[model samples]
Target: MKSSVRAVLGLAGGALAGLALMAASASAQTIAITDGRILTGSGIIENGTVIIRDGRIAAVGASVPVPAGAEVISAAGRVVAPGFVAVDSGLGGNEVSSQPEANDLRQSSNSISAAFDLSWGLDPWSITLPVARLGGVTRAIVVPSHPGSSGGHDHNHDFAGLGASGHHEPGLFAGQAAVIHLAEGTEIIVQPRVAMVAPFGNAGANVAGGARGALYTLLRETFAEVRLYARNRAAYDRGDVRALSLSRADLEALVPVVEGRMPLIVTVHKANDILMALRIAREENIRLILDGAEEGWMVADQIAAANVPVLLNALANLPGSFERRASSLENAARLHAAGVLIAIKGNEGSVHRAREARYNAGNAVAHGLPYEAGIAALTVNPARIFGQQQRFGAIAPGLEADVVIWSGDPLEPLSQPVAIYIRGVAQPLYSRGLELRDRYRPGQQPGLPPAYRN
Candidate 1:
């Protein structure tokens, strides 16, 4: 009897495994997008074809032959572009702002600083991810926030710590940021520890001491300690090295930054603070990406000269603080005009509002940014910024097949995606909200409850 039961169970397991393999094979099938207004890295193709095979773009041009038995998706009379990339997103971490346990974007009671990786507890199954994906955001750079940061889901808010909480220990650095594909599955992390986030300007000042000078001094000292710890790890482990402000794990995390292997994303808004961050990057010989640079337009020439990219909310125009007194809606346009690489965030990096980023890009175009550059800001620019240009930035050959076919102009507020593909696999545009709307809509069957109607 035992042998008979085991045989039945074995057959069932094998059948399940075979089904999984079949599903994967279907996802990897060749798909050809035909006759679309293709947006490529080089330029736009009025009528072109993109052939996707095995989860990668096989060929893209004006005339590409589709393979036999390949799935044909007609994008005629539509705009076909690379999926949008949302930077400094809180997705996969902050599901609900009110649910503290659900929000993994900040570690309020932790001893670690730079070593606090956001990818450790990322929840790829978060309901908010599908909504963002529905808005054509196939990729995102998920960043952790400081303990005392405000503005709810907004990444443009101040990233300052409350400084020495009695209940918990907070560190100078917020944490590491990660890049993730907004596709379904547990393995969503494209790159972990892509950048080290540090508070700068007012936020840094509050965390370090009461002044900006103290903040810079503390950073230099901390970096120096990182070098020392890296050079004499054995001695430090033996307690023979000098005492350091940050923990050993933090030092290890910053080694990549100090060694120029990773970029340090500093949250600074003021023009002078932006220059200071630039100077520090130059002095320390580290790569820099400015985040929340609300006043970056004021010193656009300097930022352009340094070739540092600026990430900001395109709609940030009001003087929210003294640092952003010179904020303007044209900040993105001016920065792009000054020859600086810029990535615009919509809804201030709100996870639930990520779809608004395309609208923000449209607004940027309305405020003097070129139309082509606006699209680049959402797609190729962010990918290049984080060293994923060859992986999935553009609708180019050999890149991951992350494409979006829009019903109309993608930048327009009324435009929507008719079909979306991520890594060659078609994704459903449905979300929990849409499900509820359909379930509880008028004219639904009255015999069953809304939950049972579906």
Candidate 2:
């Protein structure tokens, strides 16, 4: 009886091991995309064929031979380009508001806190992901919105809230912003905080007592404090009298921005605000990227001279306020023509509205932005600005295969991405919006009753 029991136990263990091996072997299959109008970004391929293997582009040319036994995605008569990279987007997770528990993009009144990582706030399977993916946006820089004071003790007597650069409920004294891939598995998609955000507009003035002079003074003083902290690091560490008790978190966060290693993405739109931001960048020798440059055309020459880039919203043609009077569909084109590198961003509120990206590019093209240049604004330019140009932003050998096969000219409003490959794997094209459309359309099968469907 004992011998028989031992034999049975051994057989069970062997079966378990066999099952594990089979599961491991059943990995995602490889595919090859071929015969299409490939926009390599560096140039164009009229009859191009791209070979994808192991989730990367193996070869890309007019005559790349297709491999036997590999799945072939024929792209004849279609447009193929690198998946779009949105330089700034808010699609990864929810943007929480007044309710602290509901928000993950800003903190309250804590100072000296650069340890906040945006990945912690990321929801990998957000319903918005597929909407953006199917529309050709494969990656984005998820940024935190400006924090508002929640009746807490103000950090500076004049300022009501601390504004750090992160993607969660950061205290007004929060730290840097992290780059995130808009895909499953958050761990595999994190790039450490690459920049620290600083607000500089009417909002800044309001927080600084409605005086532009006071606002500038506060900014300068903050930098001075950071400089002092850097100089007396050792003394501060050793608790010496010479060491200041100023918590270095805010100052420390500015180190990368001040050193020009990371950019200061200032959120400003008016001409005065743009000038002030440009002056700050020059004075500090920090790289600057202007976000929401609604009136950027007014200062195009100055921006070009400074070699600064602008992130603009293509659809914000209407003038919502005096500061945005110069906003137009042609602003991006004018900036590009004046030698200012321009990247198009979506509305700050919805990052998954990528279906409008190509349309935005089309509008710019119609307004005199070169067609290819407009395409680059949505693809390669953003990737270059975010430091992923080599692997993303283009279709080429040795690059990650984040290719989008479109049904027609990508810039046309009617065009749609038939298939999207992220890291060489075709992602599911379904989105919550599409599911709702199918369920509610006049004649479609009723998966659920009216109330539940709606």
Q: In candidate 1, how many Å is residue 340 off? A: 0.8
Q: What is the alpha-carbon RMSD of candidate 1 to the true structure?
A: 8.3
lDDT of 2 by residue, 1-454 (tens): 1111011112224334323322322343445566789887667888888877787888999988777655566677778888887665656655333445645555544444444455577677676677777677887766655532111212333354434532112222234566665544545354757666655676556555566676678667656666777777787677663433234555567667656887777767788889988998899787988878888888999999999988777776887766677788889888999998888765544454745677788888988889888888888888777677777778888888788777788888777766667777665556788777767777655666766544
Give candidate 2 misplaced runs (Cα > 4 Å): 1-30, 67-69, 95-101, 112-116, 147-175, 186-188, 241-246, 439-454
| Candidate with maximal TM-score | 1
Candidates in order, TM-scores: namely 0.90, 0.82
Off by over 4 Å in 1: 1-28, 147-169, 450-454
- Candidate 1 per-residue lDDT, tens place, 237-263, comes to 899997777777788999999999999
Separately for all candidates shown, the number of backbone clashes (residues 3 or more apart, or on different chains) is 0, 14
User: What C-alpha lDDT values do all the predictions have?
Assistant: 0.80, 0.67
